[model samples]
Target: MARLETAYGPLPTDPGEQSRLFYKIYSAYSDRVGVLDAHGSYLAARDIGIINLILFILLPGFAWWATADVYRAAMYACALFSAYVLTAAAAQVYGVRLVENVLAAASADHD
Candidate 1:
């Protein structure tokens, strides 16, 4: 197993542990973004979960039904979903980097 060094100490490289760490960091960052209050966060998470379910599950089924071509429709739907996921991930990463840079600059100015 690998390890990551954080202010608290070293973290295990286990997938579950890594995922929980990531979620904690993400939740903190989201709070900093100020777009979501408690109720807003809950609603946003629920809406996003439903949208993802529809995109990955219902959309493909609908596509297959509409096209009557299981293989082609399913592949196309999967490709589209994959692209959407990648784009969203890239945007999230970019936003986090932007936030980090801004924070670093502000700290440097204070110093």
Candidate 2:
């Protein structure tokens, strides 16, 4: 009988070095994707905000009156919709940085 051994795995790594390298690579990617620029930030912020607003506000309002609230639904709908929209807007604003960062990282890899 013969015994055979095989090794298949990621190579040994230095986590600290790997983290630093990935950070550098991510920065490079961001720059390539145009997220390094102020205009990119502005565009992402505007588009994401508008999308969240429509999805979280105007659309939900109709649903509330049509189904969720049977009495004085319009008022309840407006109130709930407003509350959700404000929170969604805030979160989306905060998320813009992550979006930009990811874009940059992706671009970096493409090169």
Candidate 3:
């Protein structure tokens, strides 16, 4: 398929094509770094487990210990969890943009 032209450069229009391109980039980097079988699922599972541990148990426990009020602790936990979620989302976006910019530069060089 022909790539879609943009100010940045040519970009894949098909979702599957873009995914494959990204996979190739990641695979090359992983192979060079000797990270065999580096998969998103593993990273995601680890992140989720850590987040859950902190969000569901540690945060509330610590908050309660500090505040000694169940309602206040609950509110504090909720606020902290919301901030964590937003920060994670922003980081994800930044990572995606970094990858996109790298791909664009690589493609531009090839052209």
Candidate 4:
């Protein structure tokens, strides 16, 4: 039996029969972490999002302070950082959906 550790506690092996809510939450989290496959893709995307978010908060001000062309170069940098954030977010969402689909297929196979 495969066991899943959740925020509440360890999920029952027979998740579908034991607790629907816990199973759903566990499924979502498992997908988010790419536990089944893609290894560290989810973590990589999360890290990218965090780094871009931090840069978005700090870099614009630093750019403005360093150069008088705040409107041009700073704005461009901010836009680029925003793009990175969006891309990371998209990747995470995609990964989660992919995992969910795989889990669903596996569940169907078991049934």
Q: What lDDT is reached at residue 78 by model 2?
A: 65
Pick the TM-score winner.
4
lDDT of each: 0.55, 0.53, 0.58, 0.61
Worst 10 residues of 1 by lDDT: 1-10
Q: Write model 2 residue lDDT over 1-111, tens digit each, in one string.
A: 011011112322698864565465455555553445544555655665567566655655566657876565566656665765665565566456655565445544444
lDDT sort, best first: 4, 3, 1, 2
Error of 4 at 33 (Å): 12
Q: What tens digits encode model 4's per-residue C-alpha lDDT throughout 1-111?
A: 132332334445685755675456446545543454543666667777777777777777777777867696667686968777786876778677655654554444443
Query: In candidate 1, residue 37 scores what lDDT?
Result: 39
Q: Which pairs of residues collide in candidate 2? A: 29-104, 29-108, 30-104, 30-105
Instruction: Give model 3's TM-score versus the native structure.
Output: 0.52
Q: Looking at model 2, how many pairs of residues clash? A: 4
Q: Any runs in candidate 1 off by more than 4 Å, and if so which?
A: 1-53
RMSD of 1: 7.8
lDDT of 1 at 56: 78
Models, CA RMSD each: 7.8, 11.6, 6.6, 7.8
Residue 52 of model 2 has an lDDT of 57
The all-Cα superposition gives candidate 4 an RMSD in Å to the true structure of 7.8
At residue 24, give the lDDT of candidate 3.
66
